[model samples]
Target: MSRVQCPRCLRPKTHCLCPLIPRLDSRTRILLLQHPSEVNHALNTARLAALGLNNAELIVGEVFDDLPKLLNCPGYQARLLFPAEDAQPLQAYSSAPDEQPLLLVVPDGTWRKARKLLHLNPLLAALPRVTLAAGAVSRYRLRKAPGPGALSTVEAIVQALQTLEAPTSFEPLLKPFEALIDGQIEAMGEEVFQRNHGEGKA
Candidate 1:
């Protein structure tokens, strides 16, 4: 028989990070666009980000036909969280209190797949892009990144929300994420895992 999974975090009962999930009420909302294939990936951080933030929406698809409706959602400024060379630093728009509250659209997938998301959705491509703070690094030890300066979806969302909304509201969202990574490393139960993910580790 299969082990029971937590309906919320979708992890096995012993591995569920739901208890540590924060109920963050961020003024800036999150709209995550996930590749259909990544919905069941064990290390998915997009779901965690949505689960933690009260104002988050998770949409799964490679090509979206209803994106127009999403883009036109009232009272929210739609922006893509992509790291294109010309992307504006997120803080530039965030520090302004007069700007519309953000609806941050993030893609969840490998680098190639993420790029495909941009390519497949012109609406997503045309949206203004926002990049994270300089020197920001991902603490997601569970998965190998596709390239340098890559951050998991949750990490990026957490960092972005910190700038876009009240700092205190988004900081706690990472606690469950850290716990998830630590729990997975502990389960690995090998010297290689222990030595690599030590103190001061990324």
Candidate 2:
């Protein structure tokens, strides 16, 4: 049987999440440097993030040759969002090379894949890096984070933007993400899904 795809989200019909996606605009433009492996992942949140944001750009590749061109074209302060131990907290920085609009370049993939992106892209690594505040956790129930403080790509982007952009909550941006989780739970049956996730009393 040929697998039918959802036109909006480009996912299989049984797991189509386009209906839950919301169009959002942000001054801090989002640049998702997604690993080729994740572009089509069934449960990917990075795709949702890119589609939901008005100023977001999704670039798929492991090692990119156009990093200089993309960054120069944006004319914004491009910053890398990752959890590397050396990444500085956004709050700690009070300045930049100039007062240009911010462009958040996020690496979307597994921890290892994300690391490879940074390593392969020297320009990305050289850019300033920001990490989520301590204790931020992932509400992405569909996947297990690789380590403590790990969050889904979309969650990190929203939280980082919330912190830097001065919003009491950018949480509404995550409602569709939550709905995606809920849809999966509904399909898998709440009790069974919860049991597997070790949530509540089984």
Q: Tens digits of per-residue lDDT for model 2 on 1-202?
A: 8689887777778767777777877767889999999977766778888888898989899999998988875567877887667887875224565666678889998878988998898888888887778888889776676677788888988888788777545676687778778878888997787778855432
Predicted structure 1, TM vs. truth: 0.89
List, residue by residue over 50-119, the lDDT tens digit for candidate 1. 8988899899999999999988878888889988888988763455667788788999998789999999
Model 2 TM-score, 2 decimals: 0.86
Clash pairs for candidate 1: none
| Candidate 1 Cα outliers beyond 4 Å, as residue runs | 92-98, 143-148, 195-202
Where in model 2 is the C-alpha error above 4 Å?
A: 92-98, 200-202
**Every candidate's CA RMSD:** 2.6, 2.9
Which candidate leads in TM-score? Answer: 1
Q: For each candidate, what TM-score against the reference? A: 0.89, 0.86
Worst 10 residues of 1 by lDDT: 90-99
Q: By lDDT, who's the top model here?
A: 1
